[model samples]
Target: MESDLPIRKIIHVDMDAYYASVAQLDDPSLVGKPIAVGGGGTRGVISAASYEARTFGVRSAMSGALAKKLCPELIFVRTNFERYQELSEKIRAIFFEYTDLVEPLSLDEAYLDVTVNKKGNPSASMIAAEIREKIKARTGLNASAGISINKFIAKVASDINKPNGQKTVAPEDVLPFLETLDIKKFYGVGKVMKEKMYRHGIYTGADLKKKSVAFLQEHFGKSGAYYYDIVRGIHHSQVKPERTRKSLAAERTFSENISSEIFMLERLENIALEVERRLKKSKVAGRTITLKIKYRDFTLQTRSKTLPLYISSKELIMENVKDLLYQDEMRDSVRLLGISMSNLNNENPKKTKDISEKIIDVQLKLDF
Candidate 1:
């Protein structure tokens, strides 16, 4: 498989502690101190933590109370998303100077294809170094970079040296590099998968590579074949240039699960309003509204309806979602709720029809 595909030069660049670094950059007094960007309350979750805070086991997504317990001196600073967005845009502008094929994973990370760059740079590593330097010079922040033949390896390599460092995996060294990598370090191999692989005596990339494709497929289902190819340094995924968003969504996990319909409706209204705000910000409207619900036991369900016309108003979106919520019987205590709008513009009719028919195949995984 690796032989059949053309070799590509991919670079993964990640801002070091993006939100936390931004906070320190904006305020001189916060430098070199352990700080968290989030609400400092029992119910508040940390959005980011400075590297100093991480030394004490504090992390993003951890409850503020728990983070405070981990690092008593941790200072909580409210998140300024508008400022983060401004910096992210500036970084993207620097990336575009070298290559147009930049795929942003989040406000803090991106994958770039520099096989044929606008600047005619042949070395991806050089391009990555320049990009990181430009980001640091422009925003007063550091970035880490990884360069390799594919997106998967590049992304993994990016973490090898973090917080103002870069790593490059040469094409010739790709196989050996992957062979010794810990299974836990593999992309998409989470805690559950790691335990399952260890039980199967597969703790490293070399161990995973020893299994037959048929055996892997039999054990891991669809994801098994994926593991097999990646173990041999054979990822073929490309960097897709940024495109208009296909959908806009906002979701919230409750601090405590609720069984009351009144409480659920109130949460849905807030989610719908959030979605409406995002749609307006992007200057887009959609004809379809989807309602996603997750129960306490982790089972998930989604309901969607298509409208006769595109709508972006909060009231209209909430009206559709409310209908779907009441149409279904109360299953179990609800732990999370989300609302999303799709079918924006519908400029490509065939693609829209295909997506509509196969949309159920798209699985939504909860990060928390």
Candidate 2:
């Protein structure tokens, strides 16, 4: 089905190996060497790996011990979030120069709707090129961008030519681009979902397009209709600037698993204190308190309780956490523990209106 929606020029900008690159930039000796950030200790997990480390099969979230085994020469560095935030703000400032319709997905990437930009630039492709050049010039770091008709396609295109490169899928090429795309490359489709799609003979965008909405809905439930719409280039999600923070949390992974309740309570005390600090920083309180437990076997479970009143102090937060912690018997040795608060007092309800009702076509030519 051909969409009647107005076409939008969206660009997705993504930093290349942000944390690892930052480390390299600060210390000249670290450049051209394999480095892993935040994977120093025995229980440490890699937060980010340099491309050099990645070549040796190191990756983010991999255990430090395994990463060492993968590349014996891997150098581990501690995460400097304050430095990262400082650089991220600099990059975001460049984005605002073009348009205020910038939606930050994380510290390293964002979606920018440049349909109506400040510079009156007609070509989104040129806008993307200029933004990337500005980022490199100001920050001494490389960024890749994808330009397309909508957020979803733009996000996918950005990865096509990564590590200081870009790809632009024009208004006329959106359908063909998506049709030939590998199903696994579609946003939100993970390993499990990819296997599920493959079982149903859906391996590419073209295969997905052949399936009817009713057929997709019957098998994949609500996501089936989502897939059906996106394959036909019908994503209407806009670039939301003020994305709300839904929850706040703090967690730690232990060097060794502890099965004793006494030891668990000691760890909880520190975790709760961290959560309280974050809550106070955000100036928000929450009614729902959740305890996350990760077993040594890697299985995860969460227990939560909604309170009568919102609370932010460590003493008050711990009171509910202790109750939930002891409420259930120890299933197995715990490798990780976390506390998160939701139903934030500062949350504002948002209602999205469909912007696809108007029929318009995107500009076809690149002026730059």
Candidate 3:
């Protein structure tokens, strides 16, 4: 099966400090300084940080309080997602000039199937270089690319030479490259999984490759086989052109915790409106409404209700959000409130059915 697999030309492109770079490019004064594109106050979390800020151990998703402590001089700017989205569209257009089989992971990264490109460019490496050049010319931002025979290696390779760099892992070198790779560098392995793998003596791809597929499956369930195949350079997932967004919602963290029911309801009204606006922008509705609340003590609670029909109106979303807010008594002062809608109405049935069938087939063979 390994020898029979067809080789493909895949490239993963990732922007360098996308949001922070955009901020710097727009404002000359922000360049070469430690900056983060999110609130940097108590109860706030960073959405993105500049490379300079990263030197001080600041990172996206780190608490704003912690980020401030890490880099005392860190500058905070409000997130400009609309500006980011505009640039993202420009980047995607540049990608389509090379290939139509482009799968976007987010606003900042995407995988392109350049095996058969519109430009008739046989070298994926050259294609990646030209793409990066075009992006810099058009948007004045740097991007990184990883070229390989599959999406897994390409995505991982892109991280090797980041911030206006590129790497190519040819078919013959894929196994050797993967074997020496730290298990933590594997696509699906998280911090917890890394620790678990270390405890199990699976520190590198070489160590992971030594285990039998059945042994891995026994220990890690379905993902075990997935890990086993990826380590052997056997990922077959294609680069899908249209990536459907699963959910859309908006939320906010208050500078001060509020305990008033009326105040909370008022906050939710605006949040619901924002969610509805986003839904309209995306031209999609959702069947499930989820309300998330975080208390001052940091404990989290979520309430979700799925409706029979999908909805995308501010009034309908507010109705649900208000109901959820009052569903349970306020246990403690709330610091954050959010509402998200899922089970979107615009899912691609062909993609969903293909994935479902593949899962069933794998499960049938595994007999677990």
Candidate 4:
């Protein structure tokens, strides 16, 4: 009764030294050299470091002063978030080609459920290999993958072969494989948790697995139940793609105060362009448009319009954005202008709309 959960096929895909790798990919001379991104000034921290820099004690979030002392010749560059985001989107699109059940951990790591995939391939390893290849082909970057019976093993496997490698754990090997896992490597067991585990003589997967769920809960509260289940390779969580996107809009602070209506229209034009660019890149469109304006005194006002159809076109977007801007009350010298869109069309209009309420309640249900 305890072993009835279906044999799951999960893959964890992680980019190797993601930020540093992207920098290296763009510059051939940087390859095989120690490089760090961020930390240009005296009081800055390193965002990421290449494998070469890591050998010299450089690490993410390390102070620039400390990192420089560790590696005299460490190369540092500013973080290019826009480029990083673009590459992330490109890589994510490749993953979608194989499976929609991708759960992105960050820009660099994600867990994928390949038990059921678009390619219909029974082999998760094959799908992983294809994804890795596509990423390299499209973006000129290397990525590592791990495949296993569940998310836990797959995540652990992905890091076993670092830089550019993969590992797989079959269902039958789960227990023995986890038996040898170090206490520190167990998910959710951090530095403090490690000390507690050591105190309890829980040094390995086998030690932790031996503790009753009730006993562990008594000792560790809510997390105890989690560790107990994972030690025995039990994780019932689904691959959730329920990611919520926050802040779908952007605004700007003007360099100068401008009063001309024509100038305001022109500023709104540029803002609209950026909004449309973001919408298309994210594969999203909105039914509403909003206009915000600020006067020289810093007082602000806004007006909005909701359309009957979802819009992504640049020209039409600006038209509605302009309308909203005009509708706003204007009294003083306008210093800043902004445009935004929301009220998304959750369903694609190209597809058939949902059945009418009467049809859904009567014909469809009754017919079935």
**If scored against the real structure, what TM-score would every candidate get?**
0.85, 0.90, 0.92, 0.68
Winner on lDDT between 2 and 4 is 2
Reference-based TM-score, model 3: 0.92
The residue-level lDDT of candidate 2 at 16 comes to: 99
Indicate which candidate wins on lDDT. 2
Query: Residue 151 lDDT in model 1?
Result: 89
Cα displacement (Å) at residue 7, model 1: 1.4
Tens-place lDDT digits, model 3, residues 120-189: 7778899999999999999999999999988999999999998789999988788999999999999889
Ranking by TM-score: 3, 2, 1, 4
Query: Quick one: best TM-score, which candidate?
Result: 3
Local lDDT at 152 for model 3: 94
Residues 1-368, model 4: lDDT tens digits: 13556666788999999999989988889999999998666656788999999999999979788999999999998778798999999999998887777789889889887776688687888888898989999999899998887788788889889888888777777888888999888767889999998998999998998899998999899999888888888877656665544325656555567788888778877888888888887788888887888788979887888889888777998888767767755788876677777876544335333221111122111000
Q: What is candidate 1's lDDT per residue for 91-183, written digit by digit as tens?
A: 999988987778899899999877767886677888899899899898999999999878899999999999899999987888889989999
Q: Would you list the C-alpha lDDT of every candidate in the order shown?
A: 0.86, 0.91, 0.89, 0.80
Better of 1 and 2 by TM-score: 2
Q: Model 3, 345: alpha-carbon shift in Å?
A: 2.0
Name the lDDT of candidate 2: 0.91
TM-score winner between candidates 2 and 3? 3
